[model samples]
Target: MYHAESFAAMGWETYIVGYKGAKLIPSLLQVPHVRELYLPQPPAFIANLPRLLFLLWAPYKILFQALTVLSTLLGELPYAPEFILVQNPPSIPTLALVQLCARLTGSKLVIDWHNLGYSILALRLGASNPVVGLAKMFEKTFGRKAYAHLFVTHAMKGVLVRDWKLLGIKAVLHDRPPSHFHACEPTEIHDLFSRLDLRPAGEDFLPPSSPPLSTPFTRLRDLPPSSLSPAFAATLPDRREDRPALVVSSTSWTADEDFAVLLNAMAFYEKRARAVNSPPKENPQKGDKHDRLPKMLVIVTGKGPLREKFTQDIDECQKLWQWVRCVPMWLEAADYPLLLGSADLGVSLHLSSSKLDLPMKIVDMFGCGLPVCALGFDCLSELVGEGNGRVFKDAGGLAAECETVLKGFPHAPELEKLKQGLVLQKSPTAGEKWNTWAEEWDRVVKPIVTHRPGVE
Candidate 1:
């Protein structure tokens, strides 16, 4: 699946060789310029056995079938490929054969590492499992031999570059592309709300008074049609031409999201405004003084094991929502934009784990024209810069920076910059990046291509 997206975007003549003739049809080979190699299904008598037992035997059966593929490739495929991109998990023997073929054909070998196969094995089996050691050995050997490696995160890169020291292996990193969002327009937002049956709001966080158009407002509410709907967008405070809101939103938890830092910063700003005797946004007392602050909304979108890990701090936020005004765990992604667009700031948070690749939603935030407050994690810092977003040092230091963003929120300035740069449609650039990398790939593989003979 990773290859289908990355290789095709890079303009490679990609092919997927696998079994299942009729069953694999379009779904298996739909990517551009990609072809599939398939084999006939087993006889009906063999197919009707208990599912689990068959599933257990699947790998061995696939190993046997792979031998046939090897013979067919050697005899039928007219030319040897310049590179062989193979994934693990199907059949070890088949992958070993593919590796052998790459060596014999002198094609540069590449491994699309999705995760630590050995680590997963250890989790499923006991730590003392003999197979775990063997699996690690195999992975290490493959990592050493592969001409280049592709990992989804910097954590993976650190393993290869820092730990494995696999010099010359071009570690290409990637994340899932942004969900397809039509260009945002006022009417698009309106149409979205209408489709969802959400009425325009006057001034409240809750949906409009009318019954919703959509029943289960789960992931759909995160889409433009629902989020940008006239009702929701209308509720946002009128934009201030001089200063913009600095909103920070994420699906990551408090520990990962660095919510405490943001809260502290907001408090600091509020205190500073009071010290200067700034007038409050609302009714002020004889002694009461408050700054007419840019409203900030920190939206946390996803939940589960990651959220549970930070229960203490999360509870604090839940309690502090009255003062901090945070919206944790939105029903949909569109809900975030609807909440964030009117918001003066946008923040995306991710764990600073060496294993995490990059957060995909951060790109979505950029696409929404919200300048980011991103964690200075591996690829994320490089992926987004001063222009597109601000990467913080860590969760601890994020509060001071959050305060800075609030004080100098580029509500209007940044909006103009986003419109000028068209940063929202940032994803299509990945396709372009892939194309450039493909050209580099050709250069990297050309020497091997010239040395190898056509398969006979």
Candidate 2:
């Protein structure tokens, strides 16, 4: 949706082709320069091949993809787009068709890679699988043939660089920002949160009489520090504001985003908080009466089978924290600005296990100006930057880091400086990465699309 919207805004006609029935695609129906061609999914009976059989020869999968592309091309010729931006992974065979059509018709092929599907699939299925190896070879060959490539993270580009060093490909590193920012407003945001019935975690953490920290904590690096303008700071009541702590939020309620680390971290945070409130080494109280224990509330906003499973885990950890709120996945475009403005931090946690690539929520977090706290996988840490984000090598470390981060909420002077620095350094806003990417495509692709062979 970010790419399509960006290109459309740049005055280029962009058509997106994908499986027809998935309602979860980033909604792009309203963008003026964009159109969609949804293809039907393969019949379940045919697609239900055993893993061993599917892995036996995946080239046929590519051949089937080509058939899908051929059908789509025959149906879409009337549009005659100047360029074709093909998102790889979903339609491997369609990519070849798009490339062939573009070469013949003078249209440029821009291969957008969110994840190296073959590499991920291979990782999941084991490298010994014939299909996985074939797919990797096929992907490399196709990448070499592409006119241009767009990778969501430097890590992804690194993978291609290591694998295809001789190709001299100009693979661009692009960012995905939210589509709603083009026209989001405060009232719309407030209304959206109200509709969602969401509250700030800190408010939920403390009693009404306790004064809340004036500013939310956030990390800053590679761009201007978030403190200079207070532009993206969550608008909680302003008290004596110190630099806000880096706040990261994620619901371990989905298959894609890992919940175990989050659950463990919740447990760790409870332990650390308890330790902080415990009696000093010199004096030990036999029975201290405290009204409430310090806790961090994590608000979740999605649903799935994974969510159902993780809800039990979250419930298990409630003995330590005051509450764990898992709301329905009801947030809309209008709600983001307010949440971004009010959120001190943002979080996206995913398993390092292959198949789950970059989540769009990371882009949404950057758009809202919240520094991300995400598991370090493929391209996440590279995109989030070392200073502005935190990444764990594995699930074991997540709990300790989460506890350390929460206990040390935005209290340091350096934290404020970091925010100020990022604000100054960021050129096009982080949210503008996709928008800029669309313009770059026009510059490189338009002339190629329209150039005459005989003309200089």
Candidate 3:
């Protein structure tokens, strides 16, 4: 969606071809002037069948899907497109077929490599499997055929050059959130919370009773409600003026993320909070407030296979800690930005599939001015640093970091410094960055599209 919008902003006509799935939010289809071609999708049961069974049927499925994509391009496009950009991962037969179609149409093929197909297969089927070896050869052969390549990180580019010997006009194109996500107003946060039922009516759970932070951007409340997804919504605490410190984490509920580590850290934080807030029985004081200890609400978003188990674990932990609230949710696309804006801090447990790709979620969090506590990765320092957040090696380290942030909340000077650091972090607007990228893309493909003698 970001790429499509960026190209559209540059006055280029754009079209998106993708599968129709439950996770595809309808609002995305509303991007102005951009046509969409949705391929038929198999039923959920078939798509989610046992790994072996799904693999057995994959070849035929891929052929049918590829043919459908090719036919759609031929029939719907008034003329052959000058360029075709395709995402990779399930690259095996898809990229190969797309390359064939691009050749037939005289379009320049640009492969955006997100992850190697063989690496994904190896992760699931074991690195030593014979099929994994075959997949590596298949991906390499087609991957190098692209007219140009776009990588999400420099680390990925280095790996491809070193490991696969892929050479072409390649550059890093980091993911970024839309400008609207950068600075949101308090009323907009409140209104979104109300519409999403993120907080029950009459409840007062807003952050500490201080003036809302100010930013240079326009307030979201002035925008129409039609911009938000009407289908699904999640609740948050209602009272912004006195709400607990907000810690938010979004996950895909897969093995790549060790949710157990986060759960353990939360448990440790609860234990420490209990110890600190325990009453001094010897000097019984009168008229003491019942809830003097600072509280925290940890909202974990995203749905996946491990969601149920992790939610149960969180529920069990919450039973013992009154001051800690853990809410697990699945959010629609529109609600995501508002949710991030409402958070005081972000936590990410993503163990990258490749050290090269950075977490898009963290980028969005930074756009919202939310500091992060991310699990360390080889290239994480490029995004996270002293002011914005910390990197942790284990549950113990993560727990300690969480404690430090929580203990310093509600006017701690150290927490204020972290906020200042978050504000200082800057990058070019998505439009400027994408426009520069589009220029590079044009340079790489113009000759190929115009000077090629004939279609292969």
Best-fitting candidate, measured by lDDT?
Answer: 3
TM-score of 3: 0.80
CA lDDT of each prediction against the hidden true structure: 0.49, 0.53, 0.69
Compose the digit string of candidate 1's lDDT tens values, residues 1-456: 434544555566766666642233232245576666564443434333454564466456655666676775565566787777765433244456767788788877766665555655554445577766776776666555666566655566666666666644555445433333223443343333344322211124232223232211111223445557565632332122332243546563423345555555545544543443444458455341122334344445565434554445545543523223443553454454453443334666564333345665665555455566666755565456766666776554554455554543433344355434435334455453322223433444333334442211
The best-first sequence of candidates by TM-score reads 3, 2, 1
The TM-score obtained by model 1 is: 0.50
Each candidate's TM vs. the true structure?
A: 0.50, 0.69, 0.80
User: In terms of lDDT, which candidate is stronger, 1 or 2?
Assistant: 2
Strongest candidate by TM-score: 3
Better of 2 and 3 by lDDT: 3
Stretches > 4 Å off in candidate 3: 22-31, 198-241, 283-293, 427-456
lDDT tens per residue, model 3, 373-407: 99998988767889889899888888788777656
Q: Which segments of model 1 are wrong by more than 4 Å?
A: 6-109, 113-139, 151-183, 190-248, 251-291, 308-316, 319-323, 330-345, 355-358, 377-381, 394-397, 406-456
Name the regions of candidate 2 deviating beyond 4 angstroms. Answer: 20-30, 43-67, 100-106, 153-162, 165-169, 176-189, 197-257, 278-294, 300-305, 323-330, 333-341, 351-360, 377-381, 408-418, 427-456
